[model samples]
Target chain A: MLVDPRATVADMLRARGISRRGFMKFCATTASLMALAPSMTPKVAEALQKARRTSVIWLPFQECTGCKESLTRAGGPTLENLIFDAISLDYSETLMAAAGHQAEEAMKNAIRENWGNYLLLVDGSLPVDVPEYSVIGGVSNLEMLKEVAAGAKAVVAIGTCSAFGGLPAARPNPTGARPISDVVKDKPLINVPGCPPMPIAITSVLVHYLTFGTLPELDHLNRPKSFFGQTIHDRCYRRPFYERGQFAESFDDEGAKAGWCLFKVGCKGPTTYNGCATYKWNLGASWPVESGHGCLGCSEPNFWDWQGFYNPLSTTQWGGYAQIGAAAAAGAAAGAVAALAARRKQRPVGQDVQEEGK
Target chain B: MPFEALDPRDAGRLEALTATASGAHGPDPEACESVRGRVDSGNVPLLLNEVRYALERLLDDGTTHAIDVRAIPLGPGEEDRLLDALGRGELRAEFDSLGRSEVQECAYPGVWCVTHYNEAGHVAGRFLEVTFTPALLASPPEDVRTGLERLAAELAP
Candidate 1:
């Protein structure tokens, strides 16, 4: 008659609203996403039962807050469920109701209490220009970063801005922004870069860290190889069109309606690395490349400066005027069309025949 | 043409001259292998290896005269300086960091190696200077010279 707290995965699934088949499928997806061998699903489920909750501290610097918004928009039941239910979010300015001095104290306490233990997550670039451009509670962003990073066992830079300084550190950068690696040198920092990185990517990195008690091996840019190893171009849905060299000449062209490649229109998918193609976004709804628009390549290092957003496919090298030439050609064509219309309006019905004869 | 006519007495002096300063004891500890042994092994190797490699590479070829590789090690405050240089992509150009652009063949026959140019376009004081030639560009035979240059450059700083 006594209820069992420790139920088999199937019994637990029945208690929660998931069917046995759906629970098995969930296990399979989790296994695949973790880059784990399918044989490890049973082990993972068992581990999940006894695993002590991990602590995570998310720090926001001079950023657009897009990373937080993206995390909130993660799939059903929400990644928040995993963060709160699976892991303890000790302090986050955006998520926590605690504010001002108390919030700051909470972050400090967490670091001191969990020294060489807890994970530190950061979003946004560290502003180096004048310091006044970005300040939190009278302390420079750089100062705060060094303090937190010094004792952290591991650090995760959650967005492009935090990873490679994103747009804030682009050429002729006014804010003098720098990546987390620039300021935080001692800790092992993993960079998850993108304007707003795919939700599954965020979750996978966390799960990997929690499961292994250490971060996965990172690439040259400190990005997890499992997600960022392949180019966006490699997995793009419209890659067939790119291979055939069938590109949409204009945004509103018939080829565009047919979902032709956006490479000719300056898609940086070929150079950029991310899991957008594999994971998709908005609960696997669709990514930018599938929406008939060229990829902006927000994930790659110094992408804002290195790859022009509207650079045509033929232009391979960085820093050129391919965009300017395209704009000029369009301007000239528009002018010619306007002139023809005026000439037609002035010409009489028979004048057309006379002009043809002439 | 007058090989037999040359003085045998000069050969002894030439050997002595070639051996000059090589084994001589000096106050500078770097030249003294015994003194170099006592210094912090970590710092010594880092500095000595980097500089020695750069110097050897720069002077390997006959074209360059004086070789100077500006060795800047980033410690604490130097991070900002290094980061600024890296961000601008000017650190390599200004300090003449070894790169793909520095590789080239010379007009000399059979000989082949990497080269660099000074501010005045002269090869003097340039890093990784080596003798390279056009005939060496051909395959099989070319691989031998190219392989040597690559090996030497890798051994360089």
Candidate 2:
């Protein structure tokens, strides 16, 4: 169903049989996802109540359609999907019913109608060297991205491919693949990088823009800090094991069975920054770590070339071994000092016994 | 090895771990105590202060507020501590729409805790609403109006 451009999000929701309570619930979830304090729910609700349906154009190039699946088929009709459905999604080759010339026309009309206001969401890397490597409606990926980005309010790189030149840009890159940032330099750009980023991360970014009228604060890598601020290791439930120097040696080992840290088994949680540990996947069901697999570090740049997935992080060149070394040394030093202090405390109690033995 | 290849006991352990990590179930008390020191309790005081401030705002301007408990970086057991400190009041309510929702008043008047669960029975969102009555409990004005029209139509014949 096409959402009316003039209709606010609240209007669309109401028409869909959602009550004010449901809307409030949605705002609450959005606020939580964005890491906004609970007190900000009212503000979020107020902003959404007046938020007009934004025009969104989704362009998929050399992607596997996993990102789209992540966003659309996140379990069921989630609140995120509700917001996505309410938006005026004018052009999506995979989702839109119109095809061939009719599909191209719909995109042209959307761009013309919402010039300099529409949000451009691009997934997958672009083949700059060989434009023919990927094309849609007779337009090469590179040419299409540059053309659409010119009129966009902001360009959101939706997956690892579009954000950081994913698997296609791996070593011996064949397509001369480059991320959206390499091509769309002039537009305000944000990256939601992941091998199919978390659905909440994608929608939360959109909600922040709709509620605050600006993109959420981004890290140096141009990723939303709210979702990518902390590494997966920092929040992983198995962190206690990592701290205690316990690790799963193999996929079927006793450590793995006991839910120990996957660091030794080539887990990339320590260096990979994403919300997977905290938010989980499949609607907070379980993440890679929880499911007995190491993080593939898909969200970070050049993850595919980071040695091997099953190799321990310390063995990988991109693992930030220097930081790990310093942290390990500090932990050892602290442990030594604590042990010394405990010995001193015991010395007082055993002083007479020691003297008698002498 | 794939997840299906794991021993059933191992699979159960992973499932339990996932449930515990996702806050679907509380951590075992013995395990909780062992890791208690590792977790930070600072958010509890800050949250209590926010609750106090919200309560004052409710009294002063008659404006209700809600604090999303899930948004805060709460340490283990901190949530339970905060709830215990608030103490349960007399009123309690449960409703179902998209999923189950529970709203219960706190010891302090105008302070309520609201928890929403998804259809899968997983906690989707949690909040502390500082209002005389949560908006969820009341019939929406539109719904009330529609009900009135339906009743009138039935009487007209």
Best by DockQ: 2
> What is the C-alpha lDDT profile of model 2 across A12-103, one tens digit per residue?
87887776777777787778878787778779988988888788999999999999999888866555666676578899999999999999
Clashes (candidate 1)? 3
- In the range A237-286, model 1's lDDT, one tens digit per residue, is 56545444466665545565466666667777766677776556654434
Worst 10 residues of 1 chain A by lDDT: A342-351
Q: Interface Cα RMSD for all candidates?
A: 34.4, 6.7
Which regions of candidate 1 fall more than 4 Å away from where they truly are?
A1-26, A35-39, A313-358, B1-157
lDDT of 2 by residue, B35-153 (tens): 22233335677878988998899889998787767654444456788899899999999977656778999999999999887655657788898998887888878678878998999
Instruction: Single out the weakest 10-residue window by summed lDDT for candidate 2 chain A.
Output: A342-351
Q: What is the lDDT of residue A344 in candidate 2?
A: 31
Deviation in Å, model 2, residue A38 alpha carbon:
1.7
